[model samples]
Target: MTAALVEEAVKKAAVAWINVGAGPARALWCLPVDGTLIVVSGPGEQTAPELPEATRATVRLRGDTGGLIVICETAVARIAPGSEDWAALAPQLAAKRLNASGTADDLVARWENDGCAIVRLTPATDQPAAAPALPDDAQAAPPRETPARVPVRRPFRLHRVRRR
Candidate 1:
């Protein structure tokens, strides 16, 4: 379980990045509203998984020393455009999206025009409640979807391609 103070710290964070042991981590400008972390991602915004493809994911965040800050187990829900949740979260995301193509008034319009989804991640509601307090150190390792695997690229490979 995430403590109230930790959650507040997350709320204050301008961006949160999560990777489910996949290709790469995605960072989004998010707002923690009502205990739910609301994130918007798509082609023109932050990159995120399609989300609807997975029901649950382990989200990890690190503190100043790169320590785990409550490895959150969350249920992923994709909020479609034009819904009440989208209506509420879109404006905030747009305001925070520094590179958005249009003015604030045109943000939602741009999303609808581009086809984006508002994904909300909440503490997993199904599983048994977690320990009330998380270790405030490196004792916690991020949960992985699968066992460890080999790296996709060579660790000591040259920085640039060799001349032909």
Candidate 2:
């Protein structure tokens, strides 16, 4: 896919997933790199294990026919067709790998023979601009005053006492 197309797809696909391995399940940002996807497994406060550049992968799709086979690297991975393991791993791989740096044929070959897949690299999505602040000179509206409460008193009543 073209760089722009890849970038758009990555942007659309970029999402946060829970790292279940860690207790309490932490959130991580899945960023798309040039030829791989980077998963910020945890916020800066928490430290995560340093993963290797390559490992076995399984790709699975939601409500799909079959899974694909793949191999995952630091920020990239390769996918092969007709691999159930690859399908099971696709979501995680896609979430982690965004950039398409290598050629499609190379990626396919890597998967078909070596049990790996090629992921394209895409540009990071731009954040939305902040809203403009109101001018200091803008007149402040006066606060509305609440009505004061009044107390009600009942008049004293006198009754004639009957002698027993």
Best by TM-score: 1
Write candidate 1's Cα lDDT for 13-61 as tens digits.
5566665545355556677777777777666776675554567766655
lDDT of each: 0.65, 0.33
lDDT, model 1, position 69: 55
Candidate 1 root-mean-square deviation in Å: 7.8
Q: For candidate 2, lDDT tens digit of each residue in 96-163?
A: 43464465444434445543333322222232111122123433345434366455687665986578
In candidate 1, clashing pairs total: 0
Model 2 compared with the native: what TM-score? Answer: 0.22
Candidate 1 matches the true fold with a TM-score of 0.65
Clashes of each: 0, 29
Candidate 2, residue 30: how far the Cα is off, in Å: 2.2
